[model samples]
Target chain A: MKGMSIIVKKVAQLISGLIFLYGIYIITHGHLTPGGGFAGGAIIAGAYILNILAFGSDAMNLKNKEQGSSLSESLAIFIVLMLAVFALFIGSKIFFANYLPKGQLGEIISAGAIPLYNIFIGIEVAAAIITIFLALVIFKEEVKK
Target chain B: MNSLIPLFVIVPLATSFLIMILGKFINGFQKTITPLVLLFLTVLSFYCLLNNHSNSYTYAIGGWEPIDNIPIAIYFVMDGFSLILLCIISLIGFLASVYSISYIAKFTSENNFYSLLCLMITGMSGVVLSGDLFNLFVFLEISVISSYALVAFGTEKEELEASFKYQVLGGIASFIILFAIGLIYWRTKTLNIADISALFHSHETSTFDLFIQILLISGFGLKAAMMPFHAWLPDAHSSAPSPISAMLSGVLIKAVGIYVIIRLFFTMFIVSEEISLLITTLGTISMVIGVLLAIGQWDIKRLLAYHSISQMGYVVLSIGIGLVLLARGVKPTVATLAIAGGLFHMVNHAVFKGLLFLNAGAIEHRINTRNLKEMGGLSKHMPVTSGTSFIASMAISGIPPFNGFFSKLIIIIAAVQAKFYLVAFLAVFVSVITLASFLKFQRYAFYNKSEHRSTSKIKEVPFPMLFSMIVMGILCLAFSLLAFPGIREQILGPAIDVLTNPNQYVQTIIGI
Candidate 1:
């Protein structure tokens, strides 16, 4: 029974990992196409939810989840703020100006600051989604209590 | 002087994270620390508003400059309008935090409640201060998501259902808003609101204009909980913890919904007869329907929730009247008076409605029941809560000697002045209905005789909660004094000036 449980947990973890990666792909390609931070982040959070359902809350070793997620959100916010600040030194007249040269439309370098913002947004959103879900899971009333 | 611009968002965001850290270490830091931080932030925002000479200030995050006269960076823009909103956000946020100190203690894991509360504040403050359309959308999402989570904080079956409904509807709104932004970018190739406004001003009318306007109105209308798109409001507002309900109904909807709509209408879109008419009609419908539905509700919070929709209708109707008058090039003063009345009521509603929810929570806290029929004759036991609720009820019902009276008076006056006599009559009729409904609320919740009359086993809530209610109650009386010419001249007038003349806002910030 122990071996079977371990195998099931490993399979859930693997599947969740793949799903997380796919969410990242969607977020990165958001500005170029359709999917964006909110959709991708929700998808990633869905993966975590699936893993928790399969393995139970105690099976996974998530570190300081609140602090971890909050730091991630803060870092994403910092990046957005920094990008806007970077515009100041470059002589842009206002904040968040697309200082980088627009390479070409439909290419990786196009859309100026749009992709950068999408990435930051993706990080913030993913962290927030995960945080709320984790809070709900942790705060659940024990069934037999 | 201009440096204080970022504090509006930063203070709440930082305090939220700080509370999370402190909450883990101390036994009751979640209860104590969160309220202190909120109080400090509220005072700080007020100080900033008072000290600043310029009506508008723009803070570039990390010092980003615009390229080629195009704004690409995120800007935290503060003006008289934003300051008015910021004051509402911080004050209500602080009071909610204070009330939550006691109210949330009934639940386990107090940290989560405080954390989510702060997140909501952060989102709201950011929405008020944001200068760009996309940034506003982002902040709005943050607020909506946190609120959805907070609504389900109770973890009851109904709470879950309500959150789910709110999320689905709110998600659709966000999607529409995002698509609208994409369309605008596709046409204008810029995300900055100012640049978009400037672009539209320089060019002639375009085909995509109406589409953008409709999309934005629908999106914000959903957030604002306007009449046609208000299906999710009663459930979400009633299901959340009372303080959270207060936050949702009092200021959150206005900040994220109506404020954005007004800003965009004035700044980006040219005032047109069709849009104005649509807005007015919708406002009138929401006003009538929201109150009519509210009268039937016996669940105290649910009734209050529906009233929020009703009150918001008055706001929209007044603003719509103003916009219609302005578009027709009629009496500009009448239009200003109309918008001023709307804005004034917005502030008044935030205080009284928020206080009312806190009062409801107080009753619930002592008796552990939300059903009004189950509550009775507890006024002697919970005097502070009852007295404050009386004050809040009076204020909400548009009784004289309170903030609600002045604004409603102004709105009625403006309607009559603008020859919108029918609208004026409807406005008075709704106020009467609002009064009648709350009288029922008072009779049932506090004054009605019940078998549990001697069940005076309940004591008043804790100091923090009572203190917040008292302060808000005091403000309810004090704010009415703004109707006096001198006080109005000092605060409301300047704020009204900023809205009426959009150029003053841009010029003050850009120093053009």
Candidate 2:
């Protein structure tokens, strides 16, 4: 059982990583495309769920999951907020404007502030979803046991 | 200031998940950790509120800018109104967490309870802070989905039934709201509220516009538990845990229903005379019928739940009167007063009604029953519960020196000034009946000498629960200070301004 679980864990981890990378792609291209932070983050969380299932109830530590996800989520949201404040400080009136120099459109680094905001949202959503499921997994085991 | 916007949603969202994870690894961890985290977030949010005086802060997704005066990205805006509502959400959330410390001890899964609680708060916070309409819908879904699950947490027959009913109504509301969003997007090809408002301002009137308005009213009205859409409130509010009930009754409906309605109608869309009159009619009908229903209830929570509908009716009626005056271009100051009264009453309800629910929870906690007939002479064994309930009861009944009285006074004064004599009379009449009904509660549940006293032994609830009740009772008194001079201008004035002149909100957020 342990050997099979390890094999399953390795495969799931590989798949989850691929999905996470895909989420990053989606978030970065959010402005020019259909997908953004929420959709990508949900996908990333799906990866975390898969990993936990493979490893069983004790696979992930709830405390670490909670601490890590909250910090990341807070940081991501804060980053987006700080950017808006920066615009105010610099003489821009409205929030979420493109503060950066607009590069050539359709490039990997284009859309100015759009890519950056997507990155932050992607991080927050992914972490929040993971924390939610991990908390549920851990709590259910404790209740059952 | 803009940098702080995401923290409003992120802090609670992350903390809730964290508590769930911690609960999995450690025994009894959630009971302590969840409340502590919530308290920390509440303090942080209050700090933010104090610093955020009169500026509207907006956060854009991916830092996207409009290419040709067209918004192509999601944005979040927080102004005086959203900030005030945010403070209320955090304040009530913190107290509910504190109350839950002991209240949830009887429940089987502390972790799940905390998780749903956090999710609900996250959704509410997100809704308040969201700048885009679609984003609001997403957060709205987050909050409602968790709330549906929370309502049925007990898994009893009635609970499941209530959850099912709530979900059906909730789903329909969501469907209508989505279709409204689709219509607005279909017309303007934009989902941003400011952009939509700007679009509608330049465009000619159409039937599609009216259709969208009706759809939104129904959608948010159902969530707000307005009279016509209030079928699910009595069951949904009474069936949840006390703290959760406090949340649903005190904060959830306001955030999702009335708050959204106010934000959309006042800020995002124009309020026509027809719409304003419709709102007044809904408010008056709900006020009379909700109280009439409550007078006959034996279930303690159900009675409070029905009152939630009636009290909310007071809020809608007051605000609707303000809207009617605004539409007619009549005495602007008196209309502003009416709006302020309604908004003040919203805040007061959060405090006193929330306290009343917690008090009911304490009674139910000690005796294991919510049937008013099954409870008698509780004051002898639980002085703190009895005292606090008396304070909350007095406050809700509009007695002097409590927060509820000032708001009700303002509403009555506003009603009379506007020449709505019948409304003024009915408002006063309802206040009296509310007093009588609460007196019934005090007589039967707390003070009346009864047979249960001789046979069964009861005691004051554990410290955490009592501590929450006492704090809420104190707020019921302290918040009345808003009726005084400085605080009203500093806090309430800005909120009233945001609603009265919706253009100021768009300009401020767009950095005019």
Candidate 3:
């Protein structure tokens, strides 16, 4: 449960922000690029996991963060589901219809609702992985106790 | 009409997430919202049934309709078969949720339980409604994962062990299914069931197709817990909470396992005589062996779990016979009868088996025991549980005037008409053995004097549990009216029609 060597901790702190930024970049470019929500979310989770590895459990208060992450994950999934349901109400189209206007091709804001869906999935997947990681950490701590 | 298809999956999925988010802060929100969502789904499914009226339709999600006669979007197909499955899932889901309102009180983290339950429902509804094979796999994972968590919810040593076994087997089953899906996609260049069916129909059958079929049967057979692939079911069903056990035995296996097998074999792939015989042989083995195993069990829930395999065997056997007759080009009417028999038995099993598990839960809730040897004279103190359990027991045993008898009779008559005389004999024989086992259940649990002296504090379960059991008990008798021609035409006829004509299914979707 102790923090890693001071050198390792300093290095992790210096690089974790870049990892977070890269994850955001992948999520935003999801509609036009190869790495979408799942890959990007995993990268985001990895950054947080790195922070935990360097700073120790007490530094992040992982138990409380896990609760927050789980709630956010649920909220993200809700947003995704609501987007689909919103289709049914707005137009004569079927469920998950691309009701939003197609802005353009090969752009961040294009492809109707695809980017929006990707962002929601990104949030959900990121939060879910972090929660799982924190839960395992908490479980191990409890067992040690 | 096409627009309504998504609600089956959406309502449960949305409610699940909502419950998880809000349930922590809002005391008792999980209990209230879970039942309300399921009840709404029940009404919606019945609405779907009434409106469908022998018609089949497909909804293209994201409005990406077919291009140049090839489907490019994910499709949700609602036909007689899916609609029937939808009704079963929703009705049982509603009843189980109601039962859980009281039953789940003993467990902490009620929010987690409700969330997982809703997710399971969403998975099942999605499985039945999906027109794409890959989408089916996704939903199947959703349900299976939640169920694994549910099975281990109690966190007892036995529950954890059972859940571990379930997860390993379930994982392998998913892998096999995914491998087979890869083969299918490799061959047909499509994931849509209707598109794949059309493609297969135009070309002559290949040995690779047969290979894929074998993989599919084994994979789905594992999920269905057929005789050869039934190791996880007894442990998983018995170790879980009673309401969960009811859901697993009543609808989950039928929804994800048997239902998928029936849909794929009948509608997606070409049914051949050899395949039909293979399926029938498996069904018969499960039927005989499952009951044989049940008779020796002391744990009431474990005994009922074994019978789930046996009753599911009855369903698969009848349907297999129907397939054989259809494949052999003989006795079309008799084949239709066989299919109808199977479908009716399926619905009947869901009702009675669900009631039985709920009964088991009620007894356990009151007495804190699952061993029949420890329970006795419960008919005096808990009249509702005892009476409802009796009705369920009689119904499952194929006693006359109950729903089970009519469906069993139809199956036997159909078997005889189809000239499978041995099958008819075995069907009747299994019914008898089933009766004997239930009599044992009745005697030990309700009739005999208590072997232990701690029976002083036993009482009836709470009102919600009692209410659900009573409703299911009434349905046990009510569903028997399906034996009539007028009723059969409305409820089971279209489903049989859809199964009998695979070409019709393809055409309905592709409009060719």
Candidate 4:
């Protein structure tokens, strides 16, 4: 559970932030680009994993964070479900009909509700992966104990 | 009514996550909410079933309209076939959840159990109602993945090992199914089932078309636990906790397995003689072989698990007989009878088999043993468990006045009329063997004079558990009335109509 070498730790601290930013960028631009919720979410998880690997899970308070992440994951998915159900009541009353007014085609907000879906899904996926990573690490640490 | 179709998938999925999040703060929330949601679902499904005027309904997700007569939207269709499936899913699900209120108390993380059960129900409902192929595959994964986790819920060595085996086999099955879907998509350029059917009907089926059928049958057959691909059933079913065992045995295999096989063959693909015979042959082999294997099992759940395979064989066999007759364009009445028997037996099996598993759970709850040799004269101790199991056993063995007897009689009559003397004989033979097997189950578990266990501390299960078992036992007898023509036409009639006339299904979904 100890941290890695000073060099590796410093390098991860420097690069993980950049990776986190990149993941957010990917998630935000998901509607216009190739990477959406899943790919960007994996990237965000990678950044957290990198930090955990360098600083050690004990330093990261990952065991406690696992609970919060899972709860967040549940909440994100619930929001997604609510969004779908919300659409069931609007306008013509379709389950997943996009209710938001469409913006211009090339804009970030162009696709209306699609971007909102991607963001929530991204959050859910990132939280899910982080929770899974934290769980396996905690299990390993506990088993060692 | 049509707007409610997606809610079958939606309500369960939403409640599952709600349990996961809300169970953190709310005391006794999982227990109360789980049964309430299931009860609501059961009532909703019944309302849908009875209110329908022999018509099918479809809902397109996202309000996407078909373009140029091609359905591009993800569709949920509630035809007669899926309606029957929906009723049974919600019914057994309600009962199992009620049973879990008591049964799952012994386990830690009660929230996780309920949440996963809800998720599994969501998946099965989605599979039943999905009109498109890819969504069906997605929902199948949702249910089975939850099942793998649920089977290993106890995390005991044996339970974990069984779940692992199931996952490996299930992963392979999913891959085969996905590959088949990909091929179908490549050929028809559509994911809508009705669309694919219309396209396949337009073109004479080629050898490549038959290959996709093989892939689908083998993939779903693995899920169904037909003879060749049944290695996972006994271990998985036995190792899981009893209520889960009931759900897995009673409804999971039917929803994701036999139901899909029947739906796809009848509506998605054109009926082929070779494939029909193949299905019948597989069903018969599973019937005889599954029972042969069950007789030797010492574990109560394992024995019931094997019987599940055998009984499922009855369903598949009768349906396959109908398929064969339909392929030959012969006696429509015999085909209808065979299919009616299959559907009736399927519903009956859900009730009796579910009751049987609950009984096993109750027995295991008390004595901490599933071995027959380790049990004796439990009829005096656990009256409800013993009494209900008696009803289930008699029903399964085709004794008269039980639902099983009527269904088996219809299947045998259909086989006889179709001139399949050997099939009729095997149907009779399998029923006799089933009788012997259950008699062994009865003698050792309930009626044996020998005192194997101390038997001093045993008592009846809690009211919630017994309540579920009693209702299922009542259903076992109540369903026998379905054998009468008047009652039969009301329940099994629509499901039989859908299977017999695939063109109607295609036209309805495509709105041609």
Per DockQ, the best of the predicted structures is 4
Local distance difference test, each candidate: 0.84, 0.84, 0.92, 0.93
Tens digits of per-residue lDDT for model 1, B1-512: 46666656655666666556566667887777677777887887788767657677787664556665556567787777788888888899888888787778778878878887888888988898888888898899888999999999999999999999999999999999999999988888987777777777678766578878889999999999999999999999999999999999999999999999998887777768888888888888999999999999989999999999999999999999999988898899999999999999999999999999999988888888888888888777788888999999999999989999999999999999999899899999999999999999888888887665455578998998899899999999999987889877667776787778877755543442
In angstroms, how far off is B142's CA in candidate 4? 0.2
DockQ of each: 0.14, 0.13, 0.86, 0.96
State every prediction's TM-score relative to the real structure. 0.84, 0.82, 0.99, 0.99
The CAPRI category of model 4 is high
For candidate 2, lDDT tens digit of each residue in A63-89? 777768866765676566666545644
Model no. 3, DockQ: 0.86
lDDT score, candidate 4, position B148? 99
- Between prediction 1 and prediction 2, which has the larger lDDT? 2
TM-score of chain B of each: 0.97, 0.97, 0.99, 0.99
- Candidate 4: where is the Cα deviation over 4 Å? none
Model 1 alpha-carbon miss at residue A34, Å: 18
Sorted into a CAPRI-style docking class, model 3 comes out as high
lDDT of 3 by residue, A25-142 (tens): 9999998989988999999999999999898997777778989999999999899889888888887556888888888787678998888998999999999999999999999999
True contacts kept of 4: 1.00
Q: Over the stretch B311-369, how does candidate 3's per-residue lDDT look in tens digits?
A: 99999999999999988999999999999999999999999999999999999998889
Deviation of model 3 at A117, angstroms:
1.5
